[model samples]
Target chain A: MIGEYITSNTEIVESALTQSLPPAWQIPLPLRESMNYSLMAGGKRLRPILVLAAAESLGGTKEAALPVACAIEMVHTYSLIHDDLPAMDNDDYRRGKLTNHKVYGEAMAILAGDALLTHAFYSISQAHKVHGIPAERVLAITEELSAYAGARGMVGGQAADMLGEQGITKLEELEYIHSHKTSDLIVFSLRAGAHIAGASHAQLQALSQFGHAIGLAFQIQDDILDIIGDEAKLGKPVKSDEKQQKVTYPYFIGMEASEKKVRELTSQGKEALLQANLVHPERLLQLADYLMKRDH
Target chain B: MIGEYITSNTEIVESALTQSLPPAWQIPLPLRESMNYSLMAGGKRLRPILVLAAAESLGGTKEAALPVACAIEMVHTYSLIHDDLPAMDNDDYRRGKLTNHKVYGEAMAILAGDALLTHAFYSISQAHKVHGIPAERVLAITEELSAYAGARGMVGGQAADMLGEQGITKLEELEYIHSHKTSDLIVFSLRAGAHIAGASHAQLQALSQFGHAIGLAFQIQDDILDIIGDEAKLGKPVKSDEKQQKVTYPYFIGMEASEKKVRELTSQGKEALLQANLVHPERLLQLADYLMKRDH
Candidate 1:
């Protein structure tokens, strides 16, 4: 049922994303192609799913959360596009496809990323204009999206991760990178969903706590998988962390410890969610378990 | 008097911008440095001035418009940073200083640009949250900002310009590039300022017309300046457009024709503004003249 839920909701997200972009003739061909290329490239749709799941748990309609969900996905996609640039990770592939810069060229890749990031607010604003969400909630979501994704949140995290690439001597530094770089957007995803559902302050706080726990747990699992996950399933080679000399949870704490930590954190996330008194939390609870166990 | 108004408003924007970014201690040192590097770099502050000027022309207070003004400036600065990347224009300098990528490596410059773009929406949200501008207006501004700045607007124009770099076949294509790349933001700035001030539908339409006319005219003047403007005042070399083989207004038409076009556009823009029945259209009227006559 959880699998079905994810698949169905992902379909919803995929459909909305297709409609999100301006048509080809409406914009320059290259810009349109570049933006579409990355956006349509497949991923798990985890962030947007979290948005819908969180909203549904609070009895909010998918209609209300869909635009913001797509917005979060766009933000995530833009980050991937930029992070894969030659100046950064120099990644050649993502989800087994040629990276954005590889196909579009670096200039188009960068502009495409820029366009996606800028368009995200437009996507979020639609929740109010088309879906009849209140102006106040829409504004709050906009503010939160900026805070989570800007210098103080996701970008800040990315900067630290880049800086830490030189040398990560401390676990706290690693945690900081993971929390900001990997976790902030996840937290935003959940919080945005809750906002749309009109959750109370306490419920919002509970969701935030849950998001933090799962986000970090989800990242640690990625680290574990990098060392042991199947290359084909991951759609990339394994042990990439070792290949790059990139510091990771397992690099510092070893595989057993990393796996243990993921389990503990997933439990903590579920506990937080369970305490939130939602009409339905089963799907989110199952999602945490799935993320903790995912190979990619 | 117009010069004094611009200087005073620039000061207001300067102060707001100084406080816009998260403090150094709050983010990674290098990322903080990169973002501040370009943001703090000075320019005419034309876009923010347009926001303030348009708002005031409609009898709106500067306080309500200032945040959105700063947001517009942030968007402009981000575009400049991205445009200066080695993969793009490859410029080494801007505003008489080292360009962002030249100073802070390409990776940081890209992230910094991303940060600024993301934060601009956050800044606009402040107009509603902090300055008590209505949420509906803030949401409208957010939508317009995305439209003007995203793939279908400024980015769209930049894409066309980049594609045309190989060979410009027509004046219409050149106009398309200028109108979208340069003028879209101008129109957004004017409309956003009007929204903050609660301008009537007619007023917004008039300002849009005024923005489009002046935006094209201003770009034509740039083309002219590139051909015959002073090197010292221009900061960068004159006729660099020719060096780059860029298609410009004067490239298709002679310099005299281009200059005449600028004058005609300015007159039309001012005429549109005069017919709007605004409380203080004089500043905006004078601004069109200033833009037309500007040497750099």
Candidate 2:
């Protein structure tokens, strides 16, 4: 039922992203090409769709939320690029194509990632001024983004996850990693969308909790997919996480336990949305349902 | 005479910069540490001082402009970090210490640079709110920052500078490289300070021009120092740029002509300041004088 909204919003978000990036003919040819290459490589556009949907769920128009929605996707794409660097996950491909470093060399890849990150702020801060949204509102949204995306949030989570790979793996530590590395930006995207929409304090709180739960469920589902999903659809190598000795929900706990936990989290996420009394949460619910059921 | 003001503001700028970064005890120990190591390595803090001094010149308090001052320094420091990476200039030492990747390895260095850049927006966006400045003003400053600091400005300049090393370099191309690479942030910092001070449009324009001239003169002087300065004081090997076959003013023009150009640019910078009729222009004049006379 909500697929129509998703399709339309995805188009809006993709166009905004394509328009937001600098063209290839710019002085820095390879950097822009590398950025566009990864960003243009197809994905489901889930995070950005959530941004638009979250705003719409709180009575905001999709058109007004497009800038930030695109900004979040840029950030997500940058993280993927950096994560796939030789010093990190060491992956050569993402979404079935050469990762940024593989195509443009490591230095340009690093610069491309840096450029994308800085451009995200640029897009949100300047690109949206034409829409006549209050700069203060945009300021608040950009601030929240830096908080969730930066060291104390996603970067912090990534550091911990990297450190954890070599050492002990407590469940609580894993939770911290999942919640911050994955869920923090997810929660921020939702809140940023809601803040733009002028969602109330209660509603913001509800979305925060809902996004947190969904973020964890999403990661767990990823873990499950790595264990059981097909090689072709997953793009890169399947079961590579296990091969890399990465900590996963199913690795520590049995597959059944992980499945039970994802189910519980999905229900809890929907319950949080219900508790908020959002006027139009049907779209959000459908998005959550799709995530909960997705294989890749 | 104005050296006292520079000293005091440098202290304030340093202290504020120290406080601005996420602490080392945070989950991302290496990222924060690498960021801090470079940021705290102690440069002149001239860019940030211009921010504070420009504000004070227009009847604004230093405390009010501290957040922006710190933010600019963060951006500058992040650039240095990235520039020193093995993929870029590949310097082993910066500001008299091991470059970040030389100490923490390439990946952490890259991530640290990313974290600092993102955190600059976070610091500027959230930290300045407590000073009771309107959020829109901070928003404006941050937006200006992303514009000048991102691809169209500094990054573009850097890419040109990098590519220029490998190709035919025109005089105009060199100007574009120097103006964007070295001058954009300087201009942005000065304008940002004036913006916070509520300076008139005329005053901001004057500061922008002043910064532009000073930035070019500063880079020219740096080229001169590379040829003749003491290695001990410069902190790295002298003539390293020549060794790397990097472009420079003295390389294209004779050293005498380069020195003559710096003198002209320095005088032009002060002329802009004089035309502005700033209330407290003495300190800025001193800064220009210092830049003109600096040898190390």
TM-score winner among the candidates? 1
Candidate 1 residues A30-118, lDDT tens each? 88888889999999999999999999999999989999999999999999999999999999988899999899899899989999998
State in Å the error of residue A129, model 2: 1.4
State the displacement of the C-alpha of residue B177, model 1, in Å, after optimal TM-score superposition: 0.6
Give the chain B TM-score for each candidate.
Answer: 0.98, 0.96
Question: What is the DockQ of the complex in model 2?
Answer: 0.69
Instruction: Give per-residue CA lDDT, model 1, range B1-296, as digits (tens).
Output: 88998889889999989998877788888988888889889988999999999999999999889999999999999999999999999999886799998988998999999999998999999999998999999999999999999988998888888878988898889989999999999999999999999999999999999999999998999888888888888888788778888877887889898899999999999988887889999889888999999888
**Candidate 1 Cα errors over 4 Å, as ranges:** none
Least accurate 10 contiguous residues by lDDT in model 1 chain A:
A235-244
Provide the RMSD of all predictions against the true structure, rounded to 1 decimal.
1.0, 1.6
Q: What is the lDDT of candidate 1?
A: 0.91
